[model samples]
Target: MVVGATGTTGSRVVARLSAAGLRVKATSRHATPVDGARPVRFDWNDPSSFDNALEGTDRIYLVPPPGSPDPAAVMLPFLRQARAAGIRRAVLLSASAIPLGGPAIGQVHKALPDLVPQWAVLRPSWFMQNFSGNHVHARTIRADGTIRTATGEGRVGFVDAEDIAAVAVHALTDAQAPNTDLIITGPQAVSYGDIAAVLTEVTGHTVTHRRLTHESLRDRLAADLPIEFATMLADLDRAIAKGAEDRTTDTVQRLTGHPPRDFRAFAEREMRRPRSRPV
Candidate 1:
């Protein structure tokens, strides 16, 4: 079962698992049908959606709802129900910035070990998709050829969502649980400036990274997002400026037997895709 089946990573997980001939239950609030999988309506705020979604599924790929300030409060009850219903394994999509017991889905990461016999927490680095997806960074780049950040020159090993989904598939289907947290990352760590250069090279646009103070970044973000959320995002950027994400790991290669894609490769591929209507 894949909760948030239409999400960035969950959708890919559904496709990969279904292609492997595994029975997959793909759930979302809308219950939209996914290719080669069963569709079911599931909402974190609605407990009634839980029983039907978990029925007959042995394992699940869990993705916390987007914009959720605290995911554990919404997800833990469902997880408890899933455990009581005989679900054996779970793969949680968490973030590298949030440690187990830190914040957001981190609490779920800390709680999963005792809830299931077989489980894995995927603590992936910043996603490469943020450059192309419906995020503020992507929108800003598309609009004015600028990528704003409080990260200054800090670098991140931005892993692709495809790589994250591939790793999730392995974590879900492997004969034995990995029994540990996987810090998945791209082949290299690159700065926002480096990403801007890659975008410029690939798209023929003079994209640039605009470094801002944490306060400025937070205020700018607060225009469209909740103040608390904006503050949290800005805090992450502040962490980056302090060299929080300036590293790489081989976890993706070790688990999937293939080295993760680098930023240049991702940029090339993204530029080739059909462009979305400008924001």
Candidate 2:
């Protein structure tokens, strides 16, 4: 089962699992149709919707509820139900910024071992997709050639979503479940400013990084996010600026047999992809 089936990593995971000929139960709140996978209605806010999705699949790929300051309160109970329903292996997609038992999804990470027989938590670095995909950074880059953040000059490993999905597939389908937390990152660590330079030079997009103060970034995020969640996100940026996320890991290559895509490669590939014309 893949929760948040329509999301960035979740959608990719569903496709990879389905293409591998595994039965994929893809769940979204609206139960939107996805090619090559079965669709089911599931919502984090609605606990009653959990049973059918969990019972139908032996394994699950968990993507935490977006924009929630603390997802464990909702996620843990559902996970407990999944274990009770005889589900075996589960892979959870968590952020590298959040550690096991730290906060948000971390709390769920802490309880996963006790809740399920076989499980793996994928703690991936900041996504390379943040610049190329549907994130606010992508939006601002499209709108004004600017990627704004509070992360200052701090660097991030910026792993690709596809790499994350590949690792997840192996974890879910491997003969022996990894049964531990895996920290995944790209081949190199670079700052947001470096990302902007790459896009500008290689992709022909004149992008620039705009660093904001923590409070400014928080207020900007508050325009679309709950104040509490926005504050927490801004705090993550602060942590990054302190060099907390300036590290690399070889988990992607170790697990998936290929090095994670660097920011430049990711940007160039995205720029080369054919874009859809607006209707």
Candidate 3:
């Protein structure tokens, strides 16, 4: 079973699992069909959907809800329910820089290792989907040709969402690597400047990364997003500026037995796809 199955990563995970002929159950709050798979109405805020989503499910793909004050509190019970339901293997999508117990969902990641009998936390770096998906910065860039963030000259080994989904399928259906954390990344580390260049080349427009003061960025973001959420994203940018997410890893290649895709390749593919009205 895959939670958040209509989301960027979850959608891809569902597609990949179904393509591989796995018995896939996808969860969404809305009634939408995933090709060749069952779409179950599931809401994280509502516990009533848990049993329906986990029924007869042996392996599960979990994506934690972002900005929750205590995601662990919400997920622990779900994990317990899955265990009780005889769901043996679980794969969780986590962030690369967020070490177990460090901050954010770190506590949730840390607790899962001891709680679940078989689990793997996928700590992937910044996703390449941020450029073309629902990310606000991507929308601004598509509309205004400028991407604003507090990350200054810092690099990230941005992994492609497809690569992450591919790895997730392997962890779910294949041999279970219990109680392990996979720090996944692309082939190389590149700065936001590099990302801008690739995007500009692919889109044939001047899309650049503009650095902003953390305070200024926070204030601007807080206008639309919750203040705490804005503060957390700004703080993450500060951490990026400090070189926390600057390193690259081979975990993606090691796990999937294939080289991770490049950022430029991702940009070119995204450009080829039909886009929505500007931004």
| Candidate models: Cα lDDT each | 0.91, 0.90, 0.85
> Cα RMSD (Å) between model 3 and the true structure?
3.2
Candidate scoring better on TM-score of 2 and 3: 2
Per-residue lDDT of model 2, residues 1-279, tens digit only: 999999998999999988989898889999987766999999999998998788768898999999888898899888889988988988999889999888788998999988889999999999888876678998999899999999999998899899999999999999999999999999988999998888888767698999999999999999999999999899999999999999999898898898888877787777753557999
Which regions of candidate 1 are displaced past 4 Å? 273-279
Misplaced by over 4 Å in model 2 are 273-279
Per-residue CA lDDT of candidate 3, range 41-126, in tens? Answer: 88778899898888888888999876674678788888889889988888998889789896767888888876668889889999
Residue 40's lDDT within candidate 2 is 96
Provide the clashing-pair count of each candidate structure.
Answer: 0, 0, 0
Candidate 3 residue spans exceeding 4 A from truth: 272-279
Kindly list the per-residue Cα lDDT of model 1 for residues 1-279, writing each as its tens digit. Answer: 999999889999999999999899999999999986899999988899899998988899999978787889988888899999999999999989999898778889999999999999999999999999787889998899999999999989999999999999999999999978999999988899999998998898899999999999999989977888889889999999889999899988888999999888888888644568999
